[model samples]
Target: MLDRIDATSITTIQLYNQPFIRAFEMTPSLPTFVPATQLPLAIDNGRLVLQDMLGVGAYGSVYRAIDTQTHQTYAVKSLNKAGLNSRQCAFQNHEAQLHAKVSGHPNIVTLHKVVEENDCLYMVLDCGMEGDLFYTITERGGFVGNTMAIKTIFSQIASAVLHCHSRGVYHRDLKPENIIMFGRSVKLVDFGLATTEPVSSEFGCGSTFYLSPECQGGFIESVKSYDSAANDVWSLGIILINLTFGRNPWKQACPRDETFSAYAQHNDFLQTILPMSTELNEIVKGAFCLNPKKRITLSELARRVQACRFFTTPEFPSEASVVSAATAASQASFSTTMSGVYPTSNLHGPDDKEDSGVDLQSMA
Candidate 1:
């Protein structure tokens, strides 16, 4: 089941502002997500040439590849049938389904196509060359005085998560490792643990450090179900804390854990462990409520993110975006009461030239 077709030199696409919302209205959702074990051999797309191995994981490896004709780079993730169990295979299938369902989201990595080869499933994805948010945290040693940077990254994640939920896809695993960087822009990747339905007791899947309290195995006696959407939000909160503080606040998300325990007790941990901006502080506070029902919904979280007074007020992409040329550029900012530092408006944008002026909104 392999077909090779000549492709044109398709430029790497970048979306900015609200226009990105409807950019892929015609992109079709995939019809099937069959397991690799059942696929025919040599399901490769010969039109794309593989280069270096980008990453290795439990399920498979990702390679940097380029289209032969277009020469555009893509990430090819190979999921071998041997690396997955029946349940894992099913989850993998669901992951492929969910990703195709939300194909054009700017903050979520794009999947160009799927191929099966040598009993392996390959997902061609966006090449995030800057690596992941986790690497940046280690390099920067925390956001430090850059509150605007913190807001921008967190808001992008929040908006993406909310968008997925709205489309009925629950990204059960959301962590720094899963958030890959595309220059100043970030895209959520590795949807191997994602699903279109709620996570049942049968599967409590996520990295321990970023897992929600309800998803913890030891936290509950019998296997139980969880609202994976909340887990996504909770993990995003942890990611925010990690970015702000430069380390894991707690060993785990359990009440018995030191940091989480303190959070459970009058929310002291948030204030005690890390010093952050007021807006970030409140976002973290709402995320660690321990009660899934009370935890801030993604919609509300997004609103709270956009409402930060630090945001100067988003503006249109000005004259540059409207040009017939290949790219568009736009930005806006207002005076801030806090010293000379001004946080640029909007959640996703180009990298800040300096701490004094941070423009987090996207540039077309």
Candidate 2:
């Protein structure tokens, strides 16, 4: 789904996976959806009037809706029997179950409720106006120019992931698109790939570039059992690099990864890539280390990130830049392709312009 709505009038034909559509201009107002009809998507009680289509994927669509009773807005995800397999539909139900298990974490999105009927599924989630981290990164160029802000954002993410792990859960799908922002405050969303078991399945999962070295589910014939917590930490490291550098360090993990190997051969690798402090350098090394056994745990990583000077720095221009970008993101429309929401996605895409720089070898 795309945001092609007219803010002045809340009535617009919902477009699905359209290209070159202009972003929606939204303001605080009630929705005027097309006259009640039995569509694949719709909800009841409190007149849950579905508004703008926030985002759409291969399996389903997320819409902006309003609870007429409270006049409060929410992000509603609809799963229907069009263009989706049974497994994909199951993933949606799995996500709803996971959200129910862990809903009180401050940094994670709260699942308001779920509806079942019309041979479809509707899930109500907290509506975030500021869009997602991917858009913010694009608008800001990269976080390498804003080290303090990067630390600040990463610290929050580390804390959130740590909280998830503490509750015996793991967000297997940790990526920029899944992390929505509301100014400096951030919330983790989209738990379609989340799991409670150490290794949910032998097969691969999550976005390719963000997958842990051990969890190359798609590329490898048989993936070694992976600790979900460690997988999350590795993905978090990739996110830090992606946000700060605006590019992935390599297509895969190291020794095999040429770019990472080159960096490993150097002593000032972390600082060489970006102007990171010595303490921060150590943290980066711990997170990005080729050996997962030596990598820092979520708790340790969160503690270090929260205590870091860059993370604690307040009122800095670099930090303020994120707020500014988020405000812009709030106005612009956000999109999610069918590919993005899938379990196995091409780690390399058009947006990852530097994907060519890394050597993507056979995981087997």
Candidate 3:
């Protein structure tokens, strides 16, 4: 279960320019939620019985459940009925409809069904027996030297994103934690922050680590508008980095952060720290381009990910190289200037939901 952002932290704003619908924010907040034990046990009559609590998010809680009729296991995500406002209800409906739209891809978690009881809205999802990519990466200490593994995992992820885009849905949050793994295969989950619009000005909507500079809006010089597809591409690029090195590039994608400021100012700053190959470096650079318009397309990004061979050089970066890169980046003046600062952002890692421990035998 991906932890949904709190309702209080998010400001209700208009998402699009034409229709002018009020958009719900998926930003983080303090954990103020109804415990799973407090919710009703029986769902869809007495067919589904809720078991242990899997995890809790902002709007709801996910529980390991069993279908008594079929004797099959499932995870049920239940949204709290009493807490939902009109905007939150809109968000819930939008999430269900949009997620269902993009559900058939092999690498995407399947939405089995949606059941709206009088007290809760339940989403029956595929049980990820092996937890998420974040846990895998942490356990293995990253995929630094394993090009084959990285390529296989990333290709599936990119393929899933491409499929979503084709279906007119854009998953605003694309971090590793939102991806559930079943052995070698993975399924993308958590459409809580997704939008049907191709472009959005909903700045600071996603996790801080995977946000693009344009999305990390806090400066007068920052682009007021951003391409949603390009922003997703930027997050994919960060995931690529995580897959390769097992760590985030920076705390935030703004000039205020020293590491990000260096990368933004110097072209070679990433290579200086990480031993990225030329081809991989080019992909990263393209994905992280300051201008959203110039950012690489999702299809092209997938193509490049498949084409690239080595993600890193055979050797680690020399101490001297690191110093030189840092010095050069520090000397260059900050090209993007700042005016106002963003509200203090929560620095939490990607969604850390526990595995349901139920192996899904069905793919379709």
Q: Which candidate has the top score in TM-score?
A: 3
What TM-score would each prediction reach against the true structure?
0.69, 0.70, 0.76
TM-score of 1: 0.69
Backbone clashes in candidate 1 total: 6
Backbone clash numbers for all candidates listed: 6, 2, 0
> What stretches of model 3 exceed 4 Å from their correct place?
1-39, 218-220, 316-364
lDDT of 3: 0.65
Cα lDDT tens digits for candidate 1, 104-151 = 899988888888666677788888665466545543232433457767
lDDT of 2 by residue, 97-197 (tens): 98777777778888888897656688788887765666555443335445566767887787788788877778887877677776566788877668889
- Candidate 1 clash pair list: 348-360, 348-361, 348-362, 349-360, 349-361, 349-362
Q: Residue 218 deviation, candidate 2, in Å?
A: 12
lDDT of 1: 0.56
Worst 10 residues of 3 by lDDT: 355-364
Model 2 worst lDDT run, 10 consecutive residues: 14-23
